[model samples]
Target: MKRIAIIGAGASGLTAACYASGDGRHVLLFEKQKKIGRKLLVTGNGRCNISNRNIIAGHYHGHNSRFVDAVFSRFSLQDTITFFEELGVPFIEEDEGRLYPASLQASTITKVFQYELKKRNVDLQLHRRIERIEYEETGFTLYTAGAEEHRVDSVILAAGSCAFPPAGASNIGYDLARSLGHRVYEPWPVILPVTIPLKSLHQLQGIKWDAAIRVEVNGKEQERSVGELLFTAYGISGPVSLNVSRSVNAAVIAGKSPVVIIDLYPSMSGDDLARRLDRLWSDGGKKTGFSLLGIMKERMPEVLCGIAGVDPEKRVASLTPADKEKIAGTMKNLILEPGKPRGFQEAVAAAGGVDVDEIDPATMESKLVRNLYITGELLDVDGDSGGYNLQFAWSTGAIAGMAQ
Candidate 1:
């Protein structure tokens, strides 16, 4: 039997091992951490969003994002669902087609993989980190910490990116790829909160509102996201903020300022919002400007009124047409300049990795090295939030595993 070594034991590593084993091949899965799937266990806030039903190449980003098409064509989303189902982990769909295990626990997926791996008698070496790899014409020799070496016929580098360091995320995968003559794009954190650092917004910390967020760099619109917007002491968070953070971070990294324009009422047009404010003011018998805008959360009206140059304590009936227009405009377009995105410690995924042009997407094997496969976030491709990243991981891992 040929000995195949798989590194990282993460979402991709585990999936690859499960697929690559038991075909007259002995798979050795190595993990740096004491336990397997540490990062996987914390995904989706511990729910383990396995994949998204709405898988599309457009949802992914990279220098050559089209590379994902070949991989996904080989192992589609339906194949992922069926593979998990056969492993006794049926999925349940949530909002946005986010698929989770029926148990709704990340531990369930890990445990099921553990059971299957054991049944297949694959060698799972936890706490064994492969420090370096030496490839020869005969085969490959892997060097772990303390210079312990093992020989294998094929190697799979499924070690993930440095997104969540607490879960053993590191740059080892990138380092390994580079040593093997692959070009690695500088990695940056994505899917994290942005730090606006505006004192006016800080006062509204802990407030959660469903709004639309648009990221603009140098007066040009870049990207937009619509969902829950959360206020934090440092800046903005929540799904909407996280979704657009990639663009914000990219602008900041390029030394350009990124402004986050929020639409408090995305469902309403400017005219609609102006009309609603008119009705509220007209109906206010003796309420202050603050009290008239009771549709907003507490303390929010004061901020909006302050921005509009209207006194919160002033009677709504006394507000002029100009004052109402300013208020309406402020409500429709709340501009905030964000500083930098939170670091990798808080990011859900990273933005860059080994350049996709160096890998064969159909097989996920490195073009520079034969029988060497790369998978998961280690590749340059990263997907939008809402289970897209995990879907890419599953597709790439499955393709790499099944590759001869």
Candidate 2:
């Protein structure tokens, strides 16, 4: 039997081990952490979003983002669903095609994987970190942290990126790839909250509104998203901020300031909002400006009125057309200048990794080194929030495992 060594034991590593085992092959799965699937357990706030129904190349981003097309073509979304179902994990679809295990517990997926790996007789070595790998024409020799050596016929590097450090995320995967002559891009934290220094906005912390957001870098529109907008004491979060976080973080890394423009009432046009405000004012009978602005959250009206230079205590009937216009405009185009993104400790995924150009997208095998595969967030490709990243992980891991 040929010995195949796989590193990381993460979402991709676990998937690869299951597929690579059997057929006269012995798979050795190594993880530096004490437990397996630490990162997977915390995904989707512990619910574990396994994949997305809408898995497309467009949802992913990287220098060679189109590379995902070839990988997905080999292992499509249906294949992922079927693979998990076969392992006894049925899925439930949530909003935006996000798929989660019916149990709604991340531990369910990890436990099933553990059971399956044990049944397959795959060697799962937890708390054993592969410090370095030495490849030769004969095969490959892996060096563990204790200087123990293990020789294998093939190697798969499924070590994930440094996204959430608390979940055993590290740069060891990049180091191993670089050791083997692969170009590793400096990783940046994406899919996290962005910090804005506006004190007025910070006062509105804990307020969430359904809004539309557009991110601009150097006055050029980068990305747009529509969803819940959350105000944090530090800045903004929620789906709207997370969707555009990649663009905002990239700009900060490039030494340029990024702006996030929010539309509080995305479904309403500026003219429509103005008309609504007119109606509200006309119906006001001895009501204060703050009372008439009851369309939003309790404390939001005062902050917005302050920003628009309108007195919240002023009588609605005393308000001029100019005051109404200013408030309407402020709501329509609420500009926020973002500071820096929260670090990888808070990020759901990372943007950069081993350059995809060095890997075969179809097989996920390294073009520079034969029989060596790289998969998961360790690669350059990263997807948008809402289960896209995990979908990519499943596809790439399945492809690499099935590759000869």
Candidate 3:
């Protein structure tokens, strides 16, 4: 019987093991951590967003789109649902097509994958950190840092990227790929909180609102996201902040500093906001300038007043047209100079990995090394903060599992 070796036991690694072990191949899955799915357990804040209801090629970002396009064409979002359903794992869809397990537990997803691997008779070896990978005419050989070694007919590299190192996310995949004569794009942090230049901004910590955020690099607007914006002592966070983190990290990686712009009132135009303030002043002439925008958190109005150069203690009736416009402009565009990303420790994912061009998109097999398959975050592709990244893992993993 032909033997197969799969590195890592995360989402894609486990999925690949489940499929590749089905035909009774001597499958062995190696995990660097003490147990499998440590990172999976923390996905979706432990609710385990399994997949997205609507997944498309546009949701993914990488050096090449053809790779994701080809893989999705084979194993689609529907196929992912069917596969999980067959494993007795049901799903529920929320706003924006985010799919969570019916039980709302990320552990459920890991349990089901573990059950499937056990049912398939897969040999799951934990705490086996692969130190090196060598290819030969017959197949491949793997050496663990502990001095244990194994030879197999085919090898699957699903070791994942080094994003959350504390949670056991490692870069063995890239190291192995590079050792085997494949190019690796330097990996950087993504989907993480960003640091801002406003040291006094910590005064607004714990304040959150629905706002529109735009990231500009080198004076050019790159991407914009509209969702909840969170203020912290470090900088900003929340769905909107995380959504645009990839573009921010990409810009910084390219040696450009990014400026983050927040629109506190996304639903209102500047003129409309100014008019609203005018009405507020008309009705509450004796009120302080800070009290005019009291519809938000008590701390926010004062902060905005300070940022807009308006005296918080001044009476609203004493405000001039320029003062109202200034307030409106600051409310519409709360610009901040951003520093580096929070790094891999706080990152939800990494932005770079083994170059996609070195692998066959359809099969996920290394073009430079035969019988070597790569999948998951180990590849250059990464998606937005939602379930898109998990879908990429499933799609590429399923294709690589069935490769001959």
Candidate 4:
């Protein structure tokens, strides 16, 4: 049996260890932390979204898409469910195709795998962080933080990206990949909130409104997502913001300033809204701008007034055409200029890693390194929230495991 060393012990690496062991390979899984699955426990807010009902290539963003496609071609969604079932983790799907464990606890899923691996006699090494990987003529030698080394027939770098550094996430995989002669794509903070510099905007922080945000790179529509937009102390956070974060990060990575346009009232046309406001002013017993009912939620009148540079005490009868137009424009589209996003500590996941083109997708094995494989967030692939990213992890993990 070939000796296999799997790094990281997160979802991908542990899954790889299990799969490699199932193939009668002597599998050794190493983790830097005292325990495995720190990141996994945080997924789905501790419920652990295991996979998705709709496993489509469109859901994934990568430097190489075809590689993931090929892996799914071999072991798809059904295979993932079956693998989890065999491990005794029952799962159910919420709305929007997000699948979670029936027990609804990430700890449960992690426990199941830990139990299964022990039952199967897999060597799991926690607190043994790998320092370096040496590709020798016959096999690979892995030096650890504890000053010991393990020689293995192949090394699977399921080592994740640098998102949760506290959880022991690092760029060790990228380091290993480049050291062994593979092109590395630049890593960026993704699935993160955009930080705006204006305190006026920051005052509205924590306010949430349904907004359609469009990210532009040099006047080009790079990304768009429409949903609840959250105002933050530093900038914006929310579903729409997180979804478009990839485009923003990508532009920044390409050395361009990322710009975002927000439509606070995307569903309602600005002209119609203005006309309605004008009508309300004339008919509502001559109500003041600040006291105008139904213009928005009660708490928002003051903010809108500030944005339009209007007196809150001004009566609707006294509101000029210029005033109405400015209000309409502000409500329609608010321009938010952002600085760099919060680092990996605040990110859901890092953006880039091992280039998939350097590996065979069907097996996830390195094209240059014999028997070496790649999987999970370690590969340069990310997905939108709503559990898509966790699903990618489980799907990629299952595929890599099955391949071994």
Best by lDDT: 2
Question: Per-residue lDDT tens digits of candidate 1, residues 208-290?
Answer: 99999998887899999899899998889998898899999999999998899999999999998877877777755555555
Once fitted onto the true fold, the runs of candidate 1 whose alpha carbons sit more than 4 angstroms away are: 283-289
Q: After superposing candidate 4, which stretches have Cα over 4 Å from the reference?
A: 279-289, 292-299
For model 1, the run of ten residues with the poorest summed lDDT: 284-293
Q: Candidate 2: how large is its RMSD?
A: 1.6
Count clashing residue pairs per candidate.
0, 0, 0, 0
lDDT computed for candidate 1: 0.88
lDDT, candidate 2, 1-404, per-residue tens: 89999898888898898889988899999999998999999988899988888888889999996798988889898999899999999899998888999999999988998899999999999999999999998889999999999999999999999999999998899999999999998999999999998888898899999999998877899999999999999999998889899989888889998898999999999889888887777755544446654588888888888888888777887878898888888898888889867899999999899999999988899999989999999999999999988888888888888984
Q: Quote each prediction's TM-score.
A: 0.96, 0.96, 0.96, 0.91
Encode model 3's per-residue lDDT on 312-374: one tens digit a residue.
Answer: 787877877788777888889988888876889988888889889888878889888889999
Task: For residue 211, give model 3's deviation from the true position in Å.
Answer: 0.6
Candidate 3's clash total is 0
Tens-place lDDT digits, model 4, residues 1-404: 87888888888887776776765677788888888889989877678877778788887888777766787777777877888888888779886678898999999988988897797778989888888888977999999977798988888888888887867778887887788887777887888888878666777777888889998877888888888888888888987888888888777767898788888778888777777766667654454555555756654666666766876677777777787777677677776667776799878888778888887777788898877777788788887777766666666666666666
Per-residue lDDT of 46 in model 3: 88
Candidate 3 lDDT score at position 378 = 92
Which residue ranges in model 3 land beyond 4 Å of their true spot? 283-290
